[model samples]
Target: YAGTGAQRVPLPTYAFQHEWFWLAPGVRPADATASGLGRVDHPVLTAVARIGDRDEWLLTGRLSIDAQPWTRDHIVFGMVLVPGAALVEMALTAGREAGCPVLDELVIESPLLLDEDATVQVQVTVGAAGEDGRREVAVFTRPERVDDDEPGEATCHGRGWLAPEGEPVTAPPGQWPPAGAEPIDVDELYRRVNKHAHLTDAGFDYGPAFRAVRSAWQVGDDVCTELELPDVAGSAQGFGVHPALLDSALHGGLGMLYRPGSEGGLPFSWSGVRLERTGSTRLRVRVGLADETALRLEISGEDGTPLARVARMDVRPVEQAQLEAARRSGRRSLHQIDWVDVPAGTPTSARVAVLGELSVPGDRYADLAGLEQAVADGAAVPEVVVTAVETAAEAGDPAERARATALSALTLVQRWLDSESLGEARLMVVTRNAVAVRDEAPELAQAPVWGLVHSAQTEHPGRFTLIDYDGGGVPDWGALLDLEEPQVAVREGRLLAPRLGRAVVGEPPTVDTGGAVLVTGGTGGLGALFARHLVERHGVKRLVLVSRRGPAAAGVGELVADLEARGAEVRVAACDVADRHRLTALFESLEGPLSGVVHAA
Candidate 1:
């Protein structure tokens, strides 16, 4: 049968795509076609998306110490940073998606700490294949400052290239514990390694599951070590290699390179890693110099059966300050609302009922109540419902009226619950003249509605969409149907999405809250508290406490008098910032110049 004519075309060069398929059963990755995200099977990565029409792709997921307690144990300088082995695993996982599973090279740039209570978000990006057919991929974590809907600047933890599957590893003829390999005494091994942990941040700072190296032997120029995965997660059941065990494999050989006189020694780079076989817990590892720059590893099952091999791994000394600074960056990370641009897709073609006629053409309804009654009377329900928020400027001078506006929106939320016809409908709360763009004076009076609507959205997710316009052209009303960004801003015909970022603050030559300092929401819970602090702490003699309620708000008179008695000049202005003209007049009436402002409202 073999003699029959058979033409042999080139067999696929990449026999091992290195794709990881062992995942937790029944748990599907997050993928919504409507949002333009595709499915990703990696355990850590939940969603994947190709950027526009390009070949670049982004994969994202979230991890926390609370969920993956193993990460909680890897501490360096008292920082709970994820181990480099886990990051390489992530690189391998992402590389497979880009069609090149062979990890040609990887560099861990920064430490990503996992907060005990908060989740750290991660993103892996794969770029288009280069001329040599290698694709560059990078792993970045959003530190602790992460927003589910709005991703901010991510700190790159690692970056590398995934090449087409290279030559397969060929293990030499060997038996378990090869003859002539001198056994090294390891009685004081872990104790000696951890002895200087308190004095030097470079000590083997690992906890229970991470301490996996069981014994060691010197085989001529190479070191062979035995390791067993700890009892907590005893088997490499669903992983290419148990991450803790994989990490310990690297640790097994570090003693050969890390000298006491060295200032730093931590894994910096890895290359040509291939998972020859999938499941293994007990491992026999051989570590030797592949070249002058790095160490090579041949990992095998306890019986000397090959499991994985690395062409090279380099452990370069990294400064304590660099790692410390990375931790500090996580601690100092802050977030502010940043509007990002988005596409203006077609609005929903389904019937839409507009409550008030400020903007957006839809079926007319006198009010939310009218719409509710029409639905109650068996009228055809709209697929969408919308309303324009009225700012305090439009309502009156009292910014406290903003709370009343929120109450009105609440009525609609409650009426929707009672309407069976509009059960599947969505409510779009659009504000034409409100937003807290950094360093800009927005309609503060209309801000409370945003908070109230946000709470309702939390309680009943997917029922409400918050939209704001920077007071200009009619927004591409289709924005409401865009589930991609439920909360967005419309300005100059472009849609903007809100993202959180670290708040950049600079110091001037002098620090002063001198002269007249204004505090909005100055009568409510925090307003009164802030006024007292300004008077007591900052030694502010002149103070203006402004709230939407102003003088009419209960306890405002008492608060003003109390601050005045505290050796301070207090003026409780009954002016709303939303009332641009009234606010200007109040400033003009001031005895001195306004020095500082706090928009607590």
Candidate 2:
């Protein structure tokens, strides 16, 4: 019995039932409380969680064209890509959550492409504190819908370490513009660069976006440039430092590297990258040589605020064929030759002119001489003149040697064609391995001869013939000489001739707005023309135009705006297609599988 008073009441004997109940696996009630950590709300990021008993945190998010419309603005080689600066911002955000406010270094290994309509989950993982009290950070992303039987593999975009905020390093004294720098003509620079690309086949064709270098100058050993974002690319302000802007800043250094007849170089690697600001639309960059092969860049904002610094950057030259190969799948196809079967014809009674060395073993000199002898014996008049020009042995530098040999052979043929003694003679140039099809270095050295001779063929018509013979054995000169084709090849006792085929026009493939068509080098003259064609003719609604410049290219804004008015959506990206990791990441980021790719770049 219990006494019933104002503070005490009579209690009935009953035990409260407390039994275990099922809760969601890996979730606890404390996870619902937002006491220790806050939530992250970003178009690219979804939530943040901390791992108990470990100094680590994970931030998860998704990227899609709808959630981050501006992401579609960054197109590289026809794929919608997330800018590298955005990755840096995400890492910085994660760093801030872990009490580390500084990014010591971050290297973007691959680009992040946004899917057209679907979402790609992203995870920013911050690991336990390091010996230096900094946390290791990594960024990974995967497709949302993967096959049930296939395990989803996340793509790692980058990895680096973040450190606690420390004393800021003193930057250069605030100066509007450095003194003693000679101004560079921006228009002329682009003109020359574009011209070089066209002539040398280097494959770099910057439209408006990649033309980030507004003004530049050379002061002593330093190359200084003023870079500004294009008006259409104002959305870049959301990034930590826009890739196009940063890439353009580096373009200023190109003025220093440009030579009259050499291939242009691109950034190969970056080290010790440090960013101090969130957005920088305008920058004044100063690049100096770190050593013989690397560069050091110091960057600042419009008001002289230090923005970023790179201790070292290595730049390397690239070839056009290499870039093209990287953009396509499967083996690189060789130039197709339309083979012609020339009917056997009676030997011409007229004199034939032959040029190039026939003295070396395996040279077709004996066969050619036999034909000349047979013609002389059969007819009263000498039917052919077998003139042999000895090929010079490779001497001095290999390139110079090849050039010298080619020029020597060309001079002989030109003199023969111009001479009255050889009037009305059908000229034929012959060589062994001179038309280099395998060795690119030798090809580069010998290409001019082929170019000149091919032009002469078009101008002179039936008077000129060029033949490449295998140096392993003698060729069948009788059969080759009887053929009417201007270009022929003799390999392993067989004769091949170049034949022209009518150009065939086929119906364009069907495409819909749900998928995308990527046009590499999309900002160029031809790319723009095709983009318009795809929109108007093929009914393509989504077009991704990729170039080194992307939207920053000159006239790109107008082009994009015009396309938009025409009911076509265009996204521009500034990326190097030759970068395998970036290219793979870009492909994975697409909304759906690409409808088609026009590899103009």
Candidate 3:
């Protein structure tokens, strides 16, 4: 009776869409603090300490526009930011050394920006004083990497409360530019703030030393303005005011209440400030209008007296996709490679030598002046030299013979990282199936010698090792010199290495989000953390990066303004992907086709 028309129609319920395609992580942020060191007299704090017995303190500092060049004159939508009134004068010098000197509110979450050849560090902290003496503070910042070994990722950028006092310094009440007002051309208000800082997210550029206003008026719902600072905008004495004349003392409330194509907003919150003067290079501003999203500031000194007062500042809607997701929020720094598990060892005696194409089996050495004539015929400086990397076998165009075997192992590791008696020897390099473990596909003429020796092991760290074997004998210089992992991988004979690991995924992510993604190790720091784990966790919308110091490296303009403020479509490309004719003319100047390809150079 079960014969003809296949019975079980109820079986259709198991189509299994429980999904989670996994594969995308490492965003990198982590930190704690400790290093403050001593002496701090201010002028942008240098160190203050205290945070361990709990009444909290911290402080620490550094800022760069090349050591304060008026912080490259403010900028705004064109980037250089940092001014929410320099975090309300660094929370009024960390609330006057935690005795709380009154800020009563700072809030401006994130928008530090900086990066014109970066320097940032900044800290602040404060906290623990409550019982009505107030304290809380916060500030934080980062970008100071001088080749981090561990410890970075700060961020925060302003937090509030410091009390123990309240507002007072008012002044600014009419006459000086009021009588009938109207005058405000301010060079057509800075050409409508550089034509909407080039169209939207409410733009602004202002560089003639932040065009410090100079003369402005209006006078209906108020807007005064005067400022000054420029004479090449240099010394604001030692700032308690000069954050480019208090960011042009709040751009006269964006030209007296948003106009040049409206939709403007930024300086998010200040409430009852009150400074009293610290180096005013000719001030006077004003503003007024407290509703419709706040603003009532007041600065003084073009003789009307007073110095600074806020009562309220507020302003939110910041968009550039919310300051590029708050500058790629917590800028994850990840470094993954992962393999681990090599334990089960044996051999150890060493003096290995093998450098470059003398067929790389072992005791070979045809260059480095025949190993410096067998160490001046006394030999023994070989604690391990290895090298080899000559793939593209059976080739002639296996990517131009793997770019001439990675430019002859990048000219012998730049002559073994410029000798100095081979600084306690290490070198290694060797290769063959050139790394691809876990569901493989590597040997494409030896995977560009592991992407040109991982950018020469990321600019020489512990002098290079990177093995890769899986065969043609001889790598047991006493079990590979008892192993150490600067990227290993032997396999089948046992010994893997690499390690960074941590990516578990739980569900949600089908991904494709269209093309573009080249990468190739260029925007420094592991190519902007694998292009910010492919534009914030694999929604990847086009990249390119590649490096040979493109855009003259060193945080290539803050990693292309943090992956084009996270909406992606970046490009960087300095090209030298080992140079197969400038990596095939940078992939025929790509503007299309590239669903993926990271090879991290």
Candidate 4:
């Protein structure tokens, strides 16, 4: 049953799950299987995400395709994570013998929540070459396949817990607080552990649950906690703790609050979530019981704090009829928006059935256009639509083929589906300038429209046209820039990007490598002293020394290492960037992309 207006706002949703993907470090012909089953010319790799209770999850990946359709061909994908530094390197390697086009430079792109703890570093190197233009792109740390027939071998690696007087227990393989788990100093043990970082990693902290059990007081039906997080850098702004982290924290805490029996935990939704980043030292999170089946949580740090008052969830079985009814309703609801899956730069239009009344100040489009006009009248310039494909077919023209194309180009789609609970929706793109010879040319008008609105509307009122055809939605709307100034979008708006100007083409891409490689402490200190010497003598390209008081810490160490490995000779000294003499020396080192430098005190 639905609630009344008083309880109208449904709780937001989130996911908490563990996922795995196989990682083959290298794929060499010599190492290929002996079986004639087509040498592992190019092995295929797949990643699987496992939902907490459900058996399936969403997947994220990149791999090489094979000629033969049958045998499971997988490529080795891997990534390295830096513990002390916020950096992760993803690599995807192809077979030297794989009959694929040799690439000059492979672009590795991964999206990350702005404030997430882990930062990504990408390395693209030209692997072995063969007759065919085969090139290998390495994506570090390939995800583990959750469904692999082979079970994951557990290994213990963490500090062991030592009793003040009694014998210390070494964590066994597959045990929490592993045998070598970094033991917390006695002084630090009394301080609350920072599980937020772990929980935030990959949106969940399944690993810690194994350890949280160590501090269990009494397991109950649910667990809750109020935590304070440091707002050291004040980066949090306008976002809440990722839902995955919140869910995982709840999962772990509940495991502690309610042990032994695991039940009555069904995620309903989140409500009253308020996130703020105050200029405080630590982030403070408060969780309280809202009711029988709800928990209120508020998070805040020096930068941003959580404002969610409650997390409502349900745990129940679905009746077959109810499930069937839901399926039917879902299909009908989804019918509103026509989905078209196209390459990142496919040009398509959509017909949006504007719901509600269109009054004098009516039409959301008009409002959007008006807003654009206001901006244009001021400082903002009018934006043009960028098309991804050649001129769309003129309506009714025999050449205009409105058939749906497969989404085989995008591997990310399958990856997300394999690891998440969400499913891809199908939609159509309608071309506004389509010339239909017949009055009844398969009414392209669909319930919900998806298309781009050209800023030209400000100059050419009523000239807005929708580009729609049968296919799938373009994974990246940026492809529209490849076409004529034609706006494309869905009537319901795009989930990835909404404003047209936001995706303007022709902007040069620049990676902020945190300026220079940074080390901790001043140049005179440990990291800086090493950096200074390397810069003065080494063939270093650039040197960044960081010091706590001198320079605000910048550039993760893992990133510096990767840049060096990939040919961007870099050195980092943990010293202060504020020191003029030190900073000048680091910057003055004459050179085009420094060759090599050192980072030590």
Candidate 5:
């Protein structure tokens, strides 16, 4: 199949041959033990032995929650997962048996998810040595079972090469901290990075576990950074290299990769990788450009010992699909807020101040103006005086403008708190649709302002009241102002107090058990719990779980299998509910009409 003039090299004979040979019947059992390393003791591995020659080895084991309790701490997108680093460790350990101490590279193809009720059998196989003295290694796993008739086939998760310890990399020259590097203000860095809500938009929303870039600096054409994993993630201790630690190491170059007011980037490929140490929580990293579009990184322990090196790393701009996937899969339950009600108190006769213009052309604006008129009429307090504060809309691009507006509102509130214009009367901060809701048009980009006000409310205690009024027709100021609830939504002229004892329970609504019930934020912890509840208690037979990752999410295969075993038809759809076009297309493609929707997202 080659071109007419193209030259081709003949293939060499296979380096290692695989032929089973049975031992003589007269051989002693003790001789078998002498031929191998015997038994291996590890939390996730067992039955280690050599095969063929010293260049080849085999390791078989099993993994379960009971055997590795710490795995539960490394959750991603609501699923307990076997960290990619764990697979690297297994490969390295197998290589060590074959006299290889360094890993060349490992490519992760699929995530290995641990099942809650089933033990998974693991196999790490290292092939015979090649000409260059490197051995090929592969890691595979399947569900453990007692029956031989239906043993589950193993799935390979990753493959790589290993070799004898390579030459030690020279440590950075001279004293620590490297001379002539200017320190970068970390606080401002995070502020600018988060300016456009980049964390959520770029799918890089990291919690304390992954926020390991402690500090950074810029040298001539090089970016230097210091990183350390959170103490709560525990010690890196026995790990060959903690995934979170390594992942954070890549983030150290974000300052160089990210362009202000542009799309963010993520690591796309790696080459010539090597790990020289194990269990390093703190590291120093130096990243330099490999060429026009790639980076060269050198990493060392905090004490200047060489640890790892990457010859080249290609970073690609993050696409919208990836951002949407991350936004849907990342933890949403952590940010859930529980609004507390304002305590009962008589209205003080101080001036009623409106922080911004409440006279726009809409039903919500009309309701706000009506409420203002009611305050002027002294509906709840005696002798009401009204004051209006003029505020400007944020200036600049969308992201910058949003931030500026938020800061302006906050500055005004701070000034009001410091002013001595009037005697102490409870200050009420009112805005329309200040609380952000999924799939809704945001109001005045005031969500960030609301966040600041909540913090101030906690510090000032009893001195300020925050109200988020849903825009609609005329508001019942008489009843709304009389209610002790501080945070509430006025919908259709009705005052609804959130998180207050104002809820009314009625008879349970009828649900079609035979019809499909759609659950948004499906594949999430809460969504999974609700799905089970629907299947067991409500007798729901068909369920649809919708999220950005859908069936590709880790642990989804086991989850679907379990649900199917229980006689429930489960369908996972990678649809963004916020995107109307995509959501409509999803509904159109469904086998049947949706009977109900649980908006748990």
Candidate 6:
């Protein structure tokens, strides 16, 4: 049972983005009579379990059974978090309902991943008020700090149906109370209470910012509403407003008067908030503020139907002092952030090559540009790489096919530049293909070529022409054939056949063409060999090599310069993927319309 007059804040915002965490039978206690309500011998799987404080966010978790626990009356639990992760806190509790004692409390922290919007929820079991006289059979959510330095009350704002043990209250469509009701004139009351209320450090007020579009309220401790979302809102999903919207609803619902005299400030926190479904759809939000700070918030579909959801803090006023103290000290941020880096053994990056016919391949290029910009703006790194798929399905002569493909590739590169806000960068071409140029509208064996990368009107073949630009020069090869020096490695799943030492890089002045290849991880052994092949047999107009480490391997810079002197285009770039800030800046500095990317990085 939640204590009487426990302040509660509603959490209508958590529904759209919460992750699901169904407790396994083994994790739950079989009996409340056991010590500490059936001790959880198992350490929580931090990655799978939501962890954090109501006010702070989620950080990292380590084995620390000895860590201090947050306590209030009979309820008790510990906290876990670390730096560079998220700022969140988690808690646990035990209590009773009716005459049957029961395990009661659980809490979740907030803003777990900074700038990555989250939706969360919490659940609690309650019984009849004890001789102490609180509420009978209730659930609490959205606990807030009432005093700037004290645990605030959890408020009730949404729909509520009584537990099996208690009498249920229902409000039909139009008979419920006004939405987000304004508190009774409590300024003077707040001042009077302030004079006697003991103050403690709970945490900062999350401060509200989500804009509300529509809201409704019911008398029985719940509030429901719909809101308009913000732009550029960052979510785990590539593009959306779900997470951001829910957070705003939770924090915004905490618009309660602070009791300057009270010892406890806000009342509760949440365990998990999730967005089960999202889109340009109306959201159903429910909140039940038990008091000024303690609350139970639930969001659903447009017509009071259940949907994806989250619960909030099950906090009470009596425990505010310690929570407040933890909040004031900077140590509070330790609850939700995880610090390990993604391991590199697996392929960490991939580039997709779309090989098909299209008009204005520039449009396709633009799509890639937008994606790049999103990454630069703090989105998680993309798991898949993308590039123009080389194809031979166009309806045109040899020269026309080559021109269309290059132009399409150029369009994509330019789009990337636009997304990054780089001014008018042009495509550079390089090739060392030995085949004589074919004549389409004119004798073009030595003429410069240009056009759309994928034009619908062009006739093309339907084969994947694998080209090997081994470090050794194979002057006998032609450009029309998908030529490679027969070097082997993995390509599109299967192993590429090995054709070693096909073209030597140092003696370049050989083949000539009009395009370039951007080779990331260019300092690696395979990268060097590819560079040599491009310079020798492929007649690559340019070879740009990017690496995490500078030009330290194999005198690579000197070799590229020598190749350049022989009429090939060679450039070098140094970068690291882990350095997110630096990588963003680097992307903004790149030229556009690249023929292709060898994403070895």
RMSD of each: 23.2, 32.1, 27.6, 24.7, 22.1, 27.1
Cα lDDT, all candidates: 0.73, 0.64, 0.71, 0.29, 0.64, 0.36
The candidate maximizing TM-score is: 1
What are the per-residue Cα lDDT tens digits for candidate 4 across 123-200? 122233334433333333222223353322221111111111211222112432223334334213212222322222
Residue ranges of candidate 4 with Cα displaced over 4 Å: 1-464, 467-485, 488-601
Candidate 2 TM-score over all chains jointly: 0.42
Residue 581 of model 5 has an lDDT of 100
What TM-score quantifies how close candidate 4 is to the native fold?
0.19
Ranking by lDDT: 1, 3, 5, 2, 6, 4
Q: Residue 429, candidate 4: how far off, in angstroms?
A: 12
Better of 5 and 6 by TM-score: 5
- Error in Å for residue 59 of model 5: 3.3
Residue pairs with clashing backbones, model 3: 27-332, 27-333, 28-332, 28-333, 28-334
Q: Which ten-residue region of model 1 has the weakest summed lDDT?
A: 191-200
Which residue segments of model 3 deviate by more than 4 Å? 1-57, 60-83, 91-122, 125-153, 156-177, 182-222, 225-251, 256-298, 301-303, 306-324, 327-512, 521-574, 577-588, 593-599
| Candidate 6 C-alpha error for residue 421, in Å | 21
The TM-scores of all predictions, comma-separated, are 0.49, 0.42, 0.28, 0.19, 0.43, 0.24
lDDT of 2 at 573: 84
Clashing pairs in 5: 342-486
In candidate 1, what are the lDDT values of residues 1-601, reduced to their tens digit? 4889888788675653333345433233445455778866555676778888897888777777754667766777676778888888777777777787888998988877775655667888899999998999899887445446454457898999988777687574366566688887664455444442222445446787787888887788787889988765434554567778888886655655554565436678889887766667788888877654467888888767677888888877655666766665564434556777777766667788888875676888988779878888888888778887675444654655776676766776687666676778888888755666545566666677777777888988878888887767766675555455668777776777788766554322221656788888888888889788877877778888887778899987788788878988887878788889988888899887787887888
lDDT of 3 by residue, 138-235 (tens): 89887667565455678887788888788678666757876888987777765554453332344555566666887888778777789887756665
